[model samples]
Target: MKKEKTIETINPTTGKSLHHYSYMSDEAVKKAISKCHKAFETWKEISPKDRAKIILSIGKELIKSKEELAQLMTDEMGKTLEQSRQEVDLCVAICNYTAKIGPKELKTEDREMVNDNKGRITYAPIGVVYGIQPWNYPSYQVVRYSIASLMAGNGVLLKHASNVTGSGKLLEQIYQKTDIPDGLFTVLVINHDQSDTVITNKLVRGVTLTGSPDAGKNIGQKASAALKKSVLELGSNDAYLVFEDADINLAVKACVKGRIYNNGETCIAAKRFIVVEKVYDEFRDKFVEAMSNVKTGNPNIKSTQLGPIAREDLRNELHQQVVESVKKGAKIACGGKIPNGNGFFYPATVLENVKPGQPAYEDELFGPVASLIKAKNNKDAMRIANDSRFGLGGGIFSKNEEAAFEIAEKYFDTGMVFINSFGLADPAMPFGGVKESGYGREHGGFGLKEFVNIKSVMYR
Candidate 1:
């Protein structure tokens, strides 16, 4: 008999194994998929109001278990306890927003037809939706996709990252406590080969993933081969533009927070800083100083502003990127070297004089590393910001809100943009990206329709 494979969950702050989980066998995975499909059949028949009630209960449950959930997230992924708590709050807000608005979003619409006939459009539930999520913001990542899918009356199947496996199971437990139907939400503990098999399963009607562009391409191909709908939220090196009229102090503070949030592992985190020459020196100096002073330590401590990277391998990869960028042309302004410590800790790093050939300028450095670039003017700042191949999210800082809005609306190529501030995802706004940042929008009301079938009916 073949030996069963197991995943070990390690504490990023302590570099010790906290738990281990056995991978579900191929037979079990198939059975789980079958069960999800069966549940979807029943879930689809339920009224939207009934679905909303269950979803609201889930929101309440999340609030009730916020402390425990936040601790688990911090223990498994090394996000600051404060940030983890905010993540849980964000998840609850998502659940609340989806529950309140989902029924209306999915309600049937009526229209008059040209041939003296009545036409109606209905949002119909698809079968099981398979999601492959990342470790950063473990709770929020799963909640972002799952709640919206569930509110639309579809079953959800999660293949969370190996490192945060415990958080995944905890989420499943929370859902089970709610009034949601059994098998409607399932977490599969499986390897890559088994994941491919799950995607190829006939019952999985739609697939969504949050990861790198390379992974997106591979998953897109697999889903295409199976004729399944896919939504990809890929990685990005998002840029933040600072205009000449920007408030240097506020810009520096926002940029620092943006760079270091979630240990700087966020996909939408501000990675590039393109500042106009008029205020470049002041902004760069202050930004580097602020980033340099950020406190890095155990995530459980409230005083610790920055936490360790989620994994040792990830820390090494980020260091390699910084080193290679320096070799090309970039100059380390502050905090480039990995700290001498037990945990996977790297100090907040800022790379200045960053040029096109450097990894800091060309690639996504998924850590607490900031790349600072100087431009001649506002036009040049926008140009530098739009030069990247990825455009998940970006930000602009200027005193004139009108001017910033104009540039963001007419020129910024990213999916979402912040004026005078930096933020993560919002439940009311449609979030996703254009170009290589992947396709489809989540949150707002758009997510409820991503996996639903738009059926048309006509009566004469």
Candidate 2:
């Protein structure tokens, strides 16, 4: 449980220290795990109504601290202050949404009994749940999985992203101050050493991770070795498909937001654009123009539309991807270069004629770069979109909603589809994907069910 002796959180926009967090020692890990094990039984027995009340109270606390949370997220992630506020709002909304909806959602489903004297099927907690959350969408990611799991009578043991360590501690503090039962929600700061053992421990029953494929592969393998359930949301290289019938103005508008939201760090972001041959040039031009129009500067300003990258390494990697794409014959339609600044600033970028070997088509560039690839027709567009290992979220834009739906259905690799729209998600809808994007849903009732153990008590 030895944590990082010193983990610094720097403002990606300023290259300055915002704060520092200490990692957990092995002794601390054992303590937290012990607490979680000690707390699970009581937490499991707590009525759903009481859990909901506590969740609502936590939600209210988050709302009250909205300004502070927003500022913190902005400083750590380099999202615009405006977007940061929205993230806080979304976090509050998700908490409230879970509080209000969790009871109904987690309510045991009545199953037909085979035997007259025995019982039927029901859902129950699987004991102490481990949540290894990501840095992007810090609040929502933790709450999305942990909150639902908590409502399902499972206590949570969280290992949030190292970069957002403060965010994790702050959340734990909020819950602790609310008098939420201890061990019900604990954020242990274990470093790389304990990562492998973190799941194998006997007290921990389940593990959920939102991270890279390589990380997911290792965790999934270890979790599987222990015969525990592992929910791996390994993310994706989300493809954006545009039919010729799409509204150029509308497509361009969404492209701007979709590829730049969260500094284009969203897992299901439209990293690749597949355009129908008929309107390829027109769509490319509009996309470039819209990208050029995005305002990039200080993240704290209300007027700023785009912000700096969340980390220097992320900025550098994104820059390298764009460079490689261009080198492979993709025409740099717009951006493709970082703005002159000390901050980790990569401007909104759009590239056209994105070759098959380029990152636009092959890799998931987690930044503000959009790659445009041309297709002869809808069939060809679908072919290009599905020609990748990742498949999380994608969209089809056409004036005809039916046609858009058809195209979305035609996409073989993706999980969620947006008809005549970008991959903007809702809390009430199921969000996940197929292929290398990983399995498991992250929203709606499906997300809640991810935390529950469906059991059948049949009497014969």
In model 2, residue pairs whose N, Cα or C atoms come closer than 3 Å (at least 3 residues apart or on different chains), thus clashing, are 1-25, 1-26, 2-25, 2-26, 3-23, 3-24, 115-459
User: Which runs of model 2 end up more than 4 angstroms from their true locations?
Assistant: 1-4, 113-119, 410-412
Model 1 vs. true fold: TM:
0.99
After best superposition, candidate 2 residue 186: deviation in angstroms? 1.2
Cα lDDT, all candidates: 0.94, 0.81
Off by over 4 Å in 1: 1-4
TM-scores for all candidates? Answer: 0.99, 0.95
lDDT of 1 at 164: 96
Candidate whose lDDT is highest: 1
> How would you encode candidate 1's per-residue C-alpha lDDT over 17-66 as one tens digit per residue?
99989999889999999998898899889999899999999999999989
Candidate 2, poorest ten consecutive residues by summed lDDT:
112-121
